[model samples]
Target: MQDREGIGKIMTETGKIVTETGKILTKTCKIMTETGKIMSKTCNIMTETCKIVTETGKIVTETGKVMTKTCKALTEKCKIIKETGKKMTETCKIAKE
Candidate 1:
């Protein structure tokens, strides 16, 4: 009778441990599922950010091209004005002579 009672007690303890282990495994699976969802959302956000950055870079490049053309036009106008001034000065000197 004593041996039978001891064996039953051991079986009960083993059953409880198995139940606890099953609960732990279920919680771990839930945590892993939540983590996967978060990682997917993070990847989507990063993709959108990359697209926006690419568009901004294109706009900046186009704006730089326009500014370069404007600067070139202004430089050409300055050269013309300087040449005209020199011609006028030469005419004035000849008149004084």
Candidate 2:
């Protein structure tokens, strides 16, 4: 009878340990699910940030092209003015002679 009581006590303790382990597993699963959700949101935010950076790069490239075009136009205009000035100086010398 004492042996049976000892066995019963051991079984009861084992049952309690199993129940507590199951509770811990349940909490761990919940924490993992929340972590997954947070990671997913972080990935979405990073994707959006990459898109914005890509768009900004394109805009900067286009602006560089426009500036290059403007510089070329200004250079051509200055060349033409220089040529005109040379022709006027020659004409004035010829008239005086």
Using TM-score as the measure, which candidate wins? 1
On a 0 to 100 scale, what is the lDDT of residue 58 in model 1?
100
Tens-digit lDDT string for candidate 2 (1-94): 9999999999999999999999999999999999999999999999999999999999999999999999999999999999999999999999
lDDT of each: 0.99, 1.00
Candidate that would win on lDDT:
2
TM-score, cand. 2: 0.75
> Which residue runs does candidate 1 get wrong by more than 4 Å?
1-5
Clashing pairs in 2: none
Give candidate 2 misplaced runs (Cα > 4 Å). Answer: 86-97
